[model samples]
Target: MPDPTPETSAGRSLLLVLHDVAPHTWPDYQPFVEAVDALGNIPITWLVVPDFHKRDSLAFAPGLRSMLDRRLQRGDELVLHGYYHADDSPPPRSVRDYFMRRIYTHEGEFYSLDQGVALERLHAGITLFQRFDWPLAGFVAPAWLMSEGTRQALRSLPLKYTSDPQYLYQLPQFTPISAPGLVCSARSAWRRGLSRLACELQAARLSQAPVIRLGLHPVDMRHGFTRRYWMCTLQQLLAQGRTPMTKSAWLSTRQAG
Candidate 1:
């Protein structure tokens, strides 16, 4: 990892990570949660999935509710990750298939959603969070993949921020922390896993930006290779000169003038 590019700004440096806390991804979620808890008192913004993996409106799992409650009790706040953390498209062609073929194809294709659809999803997420009386903050695009229209839709919302690695500012646009290189690619799963972990650690070491966003998928947590990478990355972050922060902490440090 390289040193963070020195800056004159007085804002707080943050690790803006999102956990894909969805079903079938719990194997990874468990370890990720443990890693987060071990950080101890750091301000983390969680993009929660209260309805688990279902694409429709439903209640949360009893145990998941308890886990969320515990996290809130410890000071982490919620960001509406996504309704089901999947595209609202219909079956015969699953969301995962769509993501792998379209979003993950490396051609830079985007999943654009209109303002009306975006707002509907946001409202649904807000309703879930409000049930726990949780104050929803900003939005993080599912899988860090957003279309131009999605970006526009987010900017039109009342939310203060949205994250992406391509942008450098921290307002309607977000300060990005990109992995050193493309970690996951259309390759053998083993190779992709190894590369992704390597990129994450390399990114952690090389981050000179005031803030960096690390996105997680539940699938990564479940797989052994990715899980190993996850643990190693956490350890590396703990070892590095990095600090954890919530959206408010970062926002508070911005120049007021």
Candidate 2:
């Protein structure tokens, strides 16, 4: 379980992360999950949003919980995404906050939260998962936008790890594992086209990294181009000798080294 060094040629680890899993989005996400499962032996990390957009909650969705339970039994990892994956705070104060709030899909739940609000949401999310008796592996803020206060709050949370777009961080130690992710933008034709190209380029560039992440959203599966690109990207990675693993497993292996 030694760390994957720069010269290690055994194979690169690829992490397939599905973001924004919730009762409302499960219908759209089900097929994507099946498609990835069909690949066989690939471990997926499902980022579950306990209260998505302040609407859907897992307590009321038995079917969704059942599906997630089955996934866990099948060796997939479940991690906290966000409590209410929607931004309800006051308007942004700084320029960075404005762009993050307005441009990052207006659902940056942890982007502007103070330590207290972030901790409150974190507790709520963890409680929901505890009710289901699901083992929590990590926390990933919505859109990977965590405020400085939220990041500080995470330091004290009893989670194994947390991630942003660029790195998977081992908690307490905060040792970063470089794992750049490639995600699609499927909101519009223009964005989809750009995202497809970006994903292709990023995959090629990060293929040599120790860990490469493929981030999928429910909306990405709805678009033909994005869906095809995702499949193609997976195939390309596999062809290059990348093996799929759960995020938690990857971190554990690295840490145990």
After superposing candidate 1 on the true structure, give the runs of residues whose Cα lies further than 4 Å from its correct spot. 1-16, 50-58, 89-110, 147-149, 166-189, 193-201, 204-207, 255-257
Give the best candidate by lDDT.
2
Instruction: Provide the TM-score for each candidate, comma-separated.
Output: 0.71, 0.93
What range of 10 consecutive residues in model 2 has the weakest lDDT sum?
1-10
Off by over 4 Å in 2: 1-10
lDDT of 1 by residue, 74-187 (tens): 777667665666655432266775666466642222245566676676677767777767776667666556665666666666666655544323435444422222233314
For candidate 2, what's the RMSD? 2.9
TM-score of 2: 0.93
